[model samples]
Target: MTDRLPYWRLSGFYLFYFALLGATAPFFGLYFAHLGFSPERIGELLAIPMLMRCVAPNLWGWLGDVSGRRLAIVRFGALCTLLSFALIFVERSFAWLALVMALHAFFWHAVLPQFEVITLAHLREQAARYSQLRLWGSVGFILAVSGLGMLFERLGMQAWPWAIVAIMSGILLASLWVPNAQPEARSDRRARGGFIRQLRQPGVLAFFACVALMQLSHGPYYTFMSIHLEALGYGRGVIGLLWSLGVLAEILLFMVMSKVLARFSLRAILSASFVIAVVRWLLLGHLADELAILLLAQLMHAATFGAFHVASIHFIQRSFAAGQQGQGQALYATLSGIGGALGALYAGYSWTRLGPSWTFALASLAALVAAVIIATRLSEERA
Candidate 1:
């Protein structure tokens, strides 16, 4: 709530960055489909960037922490993401697209984990206020999804790359606006624990496992939900609205996240998200033609992403030392990338061989396993 916080600038970075996600996540599969790539090929295309995330974040994050140049790193990554993605205009062939995906994602995924540390450093002790700023990213996502959906409905996915490039340009500009924020200094004795040692803590390990499982469960949704909806006879405009609806729900959740965090344990919040995810995927897979059920399932994004994400970031803030925050966030990003890559690969093959129903059912199973892990292993003592 301090006047000194670069609220708009920080929020702007998330806005444009997730704006990019809004364009890519909901529409990319459709774009590839237009190019006549098979479901398995589309999944492989999607997996490349996610696989890059497993390495890129850690490499960039280590440099940021070591150099104390986190903002510089963000700026560099944003610039590279734009430059590499521009190559999309040149080729649509599988090998060509794969190279584009790999190059752009390497630099693209590097930015967020470092930026998370930057945002947290700025928030300082009032980390609860994070939801207020992060909500703008949801707004950006909503705008991107709905607007691009309409544009695609009218003009087609041929123009999708242009929209994405524009969003990435915004991310580049926003990165320049955000000021660097160093982590608050702490006592020598308190900062003494090693990063690997923190990783070994039971709660920390369990949290990582549960989060990876959760992201793994999201593969089908991220990779093919739009394609699935299209196959079911929904038009681009309607599909866009459906995607926006989920993010709208996420924005509402974020608006009250501070209050929610004040009242609930992270374990409870994450547990609820996993349980809801189980239902959400099932509803998505089995009830595609039921608009009411689809709407309800979309709303579950409030728990699936909003609650789970805010809670996870807070957990990292508390668990890691000031010096290790960058790596901590990177590790989280790395694991998420790994899970997402595996999920995309599995979902792709499943969709082609077993169909969408089985693909989403597998996602539900992953969420169910995550829920069980949280209930059994994650410490209830965390707030």
Candidate 2:
């Protein structure tokens, strides 16, 4: 144990963290709707937390990077999550619910980007091991979705607040003991400047742009998929299992991500993921009546989310010079945050007017665009 890097312990951290997110993300919409909120209102309320992510991570990440107190920032974020979500019990009115959601989400969004830096720091040369560690997060998501879905089926949507509270508390506990992410060594001034300079390059900007669109396309799925399923008369527990099935597929991909990356180019993986994302959303759009196809669509989550995410991380690492790592990740978080917030906001508008099929078709188009952007423009790897 002493001789080996504690990658497994680090994986445990993500497992708990994302398990909490899985519980929080998919069910929160159903819970609010059960509280007598209308669709538009639910959209507004759901979007609040994501909107907070736009700035929360950038602010906290800058602090974490500059102060070199990454663990402290993570701990503070967790503590705020523990405190903020407690307001849910007191929040009865729509305005109060919005406030509580925003507060908790701000804190929640702060943790992951910094945590990625931590994980990367821990696994420097053996970073392929990241997939192995990250797969547990998918497992956690599966279990949370499957279990909470069942609990909701029997107990009603009111059970959500309790489930979320338990998961966040677990995240808080795990975060407390996990060590901070420390750069193995700081870069000298010249290296740092050159690294930051890459942000201005067309290739890097194009890459980040593609990533932003990819996350944007996920907004509808993130905010309204549960509502859509419920409206279609799917049982809460079954819906949960369906959500878990997607993450289970993601888990399978992550389990083998090391091998996949070894064999394929990042651009190839990313392009393929986007292509699958296009098909997946289309299936969700037109084939909503077909159970087997819907299941197949769910499984494509492995490529759409899992491979794309891993590719993004590796690309950022490869794209930026060493000194610029913290900033690079911060930028990625910033784009994802802003893109997600905007996507959800628009999806809300589309839900009533264009309906699910049109809404998802738009999402598929976004992925197709992302594929065009990456496949054509990504610069050849430097010698």
Candidate 3:
């Protein structure tokens, strides 16, 4: 198994999958705004896909576990994601956009968590190596954001859908090539029997709660940072550079993640991530026009996303037995979904009512609360 990692196949899937994310996440809201959607309406539109995350991963995970056909699910999900997104060219009405977002995301959200399990299965004992492969995702994101940022600068957001369609098509094709693999065995009968008992364990719920809150704080950034910068008078090309810069920070951190994981406890990493996130949000909210400060804040993506994600996934890998990995990953995605949906909905309302400054202040508060929860409730183990 170690000798047969299928490195390019797995990495290609991640590259193209996140490439699709790169095209959409940074520019999608801007496109919607160009089409005359208000902040609240755009928020509603963005939230639909996140709302799908609440159910899609678990449903697909169940199918994979029951049928032992994880790759089949990935291929099907990718194809459907492409098909649903292709409909965007036919209409731009708010209702049509909402339906498309939900339709595409239902399958899109399922691919990653299940693929994470497959990747970990392939890595077996060398779990730290997971970052090496996953970093290509950050690279893909950087390429998409930076390149498309420049393209959209000249051609306008009207070109956005075509870029996304091309990337989504790439994802569908890549999914067809990844070979299926199973996680290694474990002796926990509870995975097959008492699933509820696993949920009630020490730190599990607390960890998930913290993760949800962290993502909730990201609502404004994920949904509106591009628009936010544009409102601050930055060009789309610069906006793309800012977005790519954040992912670039994440990519660099991933390069060193194995060393960082070996040295620091997961508790330390998570706690620091939450704390830094609080500062990052505050800076983005109040100091966005200051290029130096904005750059500094974006670099904090290393802590906010890079460290937080690596730690959380490692924690999940350690906590769940082999048979339960699917459900565990699904729960993570679901909780993240719930947080993201609420965050987007709240940010939508808040951006109109509270304005960007206070809205981001609220986001900082969310991260602070998450940090406090982690400090007190979570253990200091080196997961």
Best by TM-score: 1
* Candidate 3 C-alpha error for residue 55, in Å: 1.1
The C-alpha RMSD in Å for every predicted model, in order, reads: 1.1, 1.9, 1.4
| Per-model CA lDDT versus the true structure | 0.92, 0.83, 0.89
lDDT of 1 by residue, 249-351 (tens): 9999999999998898888999999999999999999998899999999999999999999999999888888888889999899889998999999999999
Q: Considering only N, C-alpha and C atoms within 3 Å, which residue pairs clash in candidate 2?
A: none
Cα error, candidate 1, residue 163 (Å): 0.7
- For candidate 2, lDDT tens digit of each residue in 1-383? 12456666677778889898789778877888888877678778877877787788778867876787777778889889989999999957998988898899889888888888888887777877788888888889988989988988889888788888888888888887786657566554435546557776656888888878998889889988898887777888889989998999998899899999999888889899989999998998888667899899999999999999998888877666544566678788878877787778888888899999999999999999999998898765521
Model 3, 1-383: lDDT tens digits are: 26688888888888998887789889989999999999999999988988998999889877776776777888888888889989998888888888899999999988898898998888888899888888888889999999999999899889998899899888888888888899877666546554457777778899999888998999999999999999999999999999999999999999999999989888889999999999999999999999999999999998999889888889988887787788888889998999999889999999989999998999999999999999888888823
Worst 10 residues of 2 by lDDT: 186-195
Cα deviation at 288, candidate 2, in Å, is 1.8
Task: Determine the C-alpha RMSD for candidate 2 after optimal superposition of all C-alphas.
Answer: 1.9
Error of 1 at 52 (Å): 0.7
Q: Give the lDDT of residue 263 in candidate 2.
A: 91
